[model samples]
Target chain A: MNALLRNKLRAFLTMLGIIIGVASVIAMLGIGQGSKLSIQQQIAGMGLNLVTVVPGSQQRGGVQFGASTMQSLKETDVAAILSDCPAVLAASPEVRGNGQAVFGALNWPTSLYGENESYLQIRERSVTNGRMFTDRELSSAAKVCLMGQTVVKNLFGEGADPVGQVIRFKKIPFLVIGVLDSKGLNTFGQDQDDLILAPYTTVQKRVLAITWVQSIYTSAVDSKSTADAATQIEETVRRQHKIKASDQDDFTIRNQTELLSTFSSVSNILTILLGAIAGISLLVGGIGIMNIMYVSVTERTREIGLRMAIGGKGFDILLQFLTESILLSITGGIIGILLGIAASKIIGSTMGWPIVVLPSSEILSFAVCTVIGVFFGWYPARKAASLDPIDALRYE
Target chain B: MKKLIEIIKLKKDYYVGEVTVHALRGVDMVVNEGEFVAIMGASGSGKSTMLNIIGCLDKPTEGEYILDGISISSLSKNDLSGLRNQKLGFVFQTYNLLPRTNALDNVELPLLYNKTVKTKERIERAKSALESVGLSDRMHHKPNQLSGGQQQRVAIARSLVNDPVVILADEATGNLDTRTSYEIMALFQELNNKGKTIVFVTHEPDIARCATRNIIFKDGVILRESEVKDRINALEMLASIPLEAD
Candidate 1:
């Protein structure tokens, strides 16, 4: 301890390597963990037990046309999935088109979605004001619709009740029956509350004059059975389309659990990569300790000899050097932890990145510092302990 | 008188690559308690080899070395260190005191290895040792702050702090001027009068004349041995030397 204090500048410089290593490890891990948690939260907000079936791409003469171009899925697939697939809780057929909605003198461009009464349930959305359009209204091909928070805000002004108000889309008048609860922005930064929903029959017969639906959205009995519901929907759709055995699926089925796993795995790899890079810095820090210790042992050779001549045992010399290095590393570890937490907070606020510091990372870094101290400190201490008293005394 | 050191036919050989250099060849010597013995020789004459063996810092190839009635050949490395701590003291020509440490702390160094000596007792013993060497006023001064003579005095204080059975000094006055050399020799003579067994090694005949007995060495063997019938009084010699102008 006296020796280390005597060479204050050298000791602090040696500890700087360890300090930077530990701080970077902790900060990198925090960012990685924070990003992973944010991804999971956003995926959870999407909905529960959801399974979406979309028309696969059409490949005519090997020149592939992208997804939703085949028109493989139809309105009949929704009925077939609800009745045949016992795992399904509810299902809805969807058709969409872009149009400008007008209310009085106010107008805003928005997406128009055509869906049945079960669409809100499958998507885990609810009407905040008024009620949903009835089955009688759908059978009569009623021009009734529901307005999302964004559309209502743009057409009728902010906080205005658009229910019972009339809006026009493509020169056709429609009555707004209800207002959807606000959902804010999704993971992709797209506004969830920016669309208007109407009966699928009204969209197909009155708006587009098309017979086939674009996609089918369904919900499973529970979150655990989401994959099973997707499989059953695939089987029923294939049978309806007459896609024979040993042929490729004409419609692709995706479930929430599969999407969640895919996203989590990607984030997990990112976390590991970040940790490994930080670990390389830590390894370099250990090498720095070894280099400094070697130089210290050489510089103090005569001192070691004098101590030995004065009756200090070899083991005592070894213990002295080892203790010095360990003390250096532990002190650096403590300062690094504080610095890392401060850095993480700064990054979180300034860069707008999520940062979550785990207690386990702190504990792990502390333990690693001790191990590094011992491992890198061993060889030089042994060299000091093994010196011949006579030769060492004569050393210049 | 009880014998503090006993060596029978001590032999030390050094193998420098292919050839062997006989550092010490079949030597026998002894020093009884309360005796001042000086071993005098030139370089390569085995005087240092003899001192190293007596100090328990080196092992003899073919002999028995017993210090304070314990056989050195039978002891392990750790035991030899413990023996050096408890029974033998060493004073180097260069005044090997720790650089940044104060005189008192340097004096207290040997006692640090003796775990039984508590900090309080160690400090008290170190203070008394410094006082005995006439360095009480310089206790807090570091080696760099002190003069050459003062640094040697600090080294002497360090050796005395352990209260060893024999104090082995190699060329103790070699680095000092005539006046300071006599002054240090007078300190040793005073310590000897108090019954401290001193073994001083030097090549200078005048310094050898300060001891009660002298043993001369040549070609790794004892050339001659005699009692100093006309031993020089270091105090009287110090009085004869002219003091330097301030």
Candidate 2:
């Protein structure tokens, strides 16, 4: 320890590799974990235990038509799923269209979604201002609708209350009854608050003039029962369509759990890759320790001889050198940990990345450094210990 | 008188690839307690090898060496180190005090190897040892801060700190000037008068004359041995040399 303190600059330089290595390890892992958590939060924001059934691709005379064009999912399928699937809590039939919404002289292009009253609950949305449309409004194919924040901002200007105001979508007049809470942008960079919601019967009768829904959105009783609810909905839908056992289903089910797991696995692989790259740097740091220790032993040959001459033993000399290296590495480790955490915090704020510094990573890096210290310090210390006292004394 | 060092039929062989160089052919000698002896020889005359054997730093190829009644030839490496710590002190030609360390700490080094000496006692002993070598004033000065003679004094103090059976000096004044050499010799004579056993090694006759007895080595054997009939007092010699103010 005293030996290391004697040449403070050299000691610090030798520890540079370790500091950088540990700091990088910590920073990389933090970013990996942070991004992973952010992804999860964004996905969860879409809604929990939510499942969607979209119409599969269809073929007529061996000519293929792409997905969501089959017109196989009807309003009855949503009702059948809710009644037959015990795991389902709520279900809504959906019809989607894109049109320009006009208010007074202002107009904005946006999406319009047609759904029943249960649509808000299944999508985990709420009416922040006015009330949602009642079932009577759905039965009558009422044109009353709810506006999202983006639509409200574009058509009616910011902070303007759109409820009870009239807007025209595709030249058809509709009365706005409520404004949905803001959800910002989702993981795919799509604006969740840029659409308007109205009764599915209105879009089916007046907009597309089709009897079939584009898709069905359903919520499960709990997150754990989502898969079971998906399976039950598939069976119920198949039975309603009276599809044969040998034939392929005309609808496909997608759930949040599958999406969540896929994202989690990808992020986990990314974390490991980053950690492995950082570990290589740590290995380089260990080699640096070994190199310095060897140089130190060679430079202090006379000192070792003098100590031995004055009654110091081989074991004592070994311990002295080993202790110095260990002290160097551990000091570097501590400083690196501090620098890493600071770097993580800075990145988190400056880059807007969610940074989570896991305690396990810090402990893992600390323990690894100590092991590196011992492993790299051993050979040089042993070389010093095994030197011949007479030859060492005579060494220039 | 008690025998502090005993050597009988001591022979040392060194292998230089194909040839075995005989460093010490059969040699027999003994020094009693409180006697100052000088081992004299030219380069490669086996005097350094004898000193190394006496210092317990090396094991002889074939010999019987007993220091203060303990047989050194039968001891293990660890036991030899313990023996060196307990019963031996060494002073070198270059005054090999650790650089950047103060005189007190340099002197305290030998006692550091001795587990029985506590820190408080170690410090006290080191202080007294430095005082005995007349380096009490320079106790806190580093080796680089002191002159060559003062550095030698610190080395002597370190040798005395452990209260060993004998002090073995290999050209202790080899690197010093005439005035400083005599000054160090004078300190050695003073320690001798206080009944400390010392074995001084040198090639200079004048330096050898400071000791009570001398043994000359030639071609790996002792050529002659004699007691100093007219022992020169280093203090008187220092007085004879006219002082030049620095």
Best by lDDT: 2
lDDT digits (tens) for residues A1-396 of candidate 1: 788888889988888888888888899999998898888767766865888999998989988899868887888888899899999999998999899998889898998899999988888789999989889887787999998999999998888888888899987899999999899998679999999999988988888889898988898998789889988999999999999899998888887797788888998898899989988888888888889999999998988888898899999999988998888888878787888888989999999999999999999999999999989999999999999888887789
Q: Which run of 10 residues does model 2 chain B get worst, by summed lDDT? A: B237-246
* Highest-scoring model, TM-score: 2
Under CAPRI classification, how is model 1 graded?
medium
Q: Chain B TM-score of all predictions, in order? A: 0.98, 0.98
**Predicted structure 2: lDDT:** 0.92
Give the C-alpha miss distance for residue A350 in model 1, angstroms: 2.2
Per-residue accuracy of model 2 over A178-204 as CA lDDT, tens digit each? 999999988679999999899999988
Please report how far candidate 2 places residue B241 from its true position, in Å: 2.7
Q: What are the lDDT scores of the predictions, listed in order?
A: 0.90, 0.92
Tell me the TM-score for chain B of model 1: 0.98
The TM-score of candidate 2 is 0.84
Compute fnat per model: 0.51, 0.58
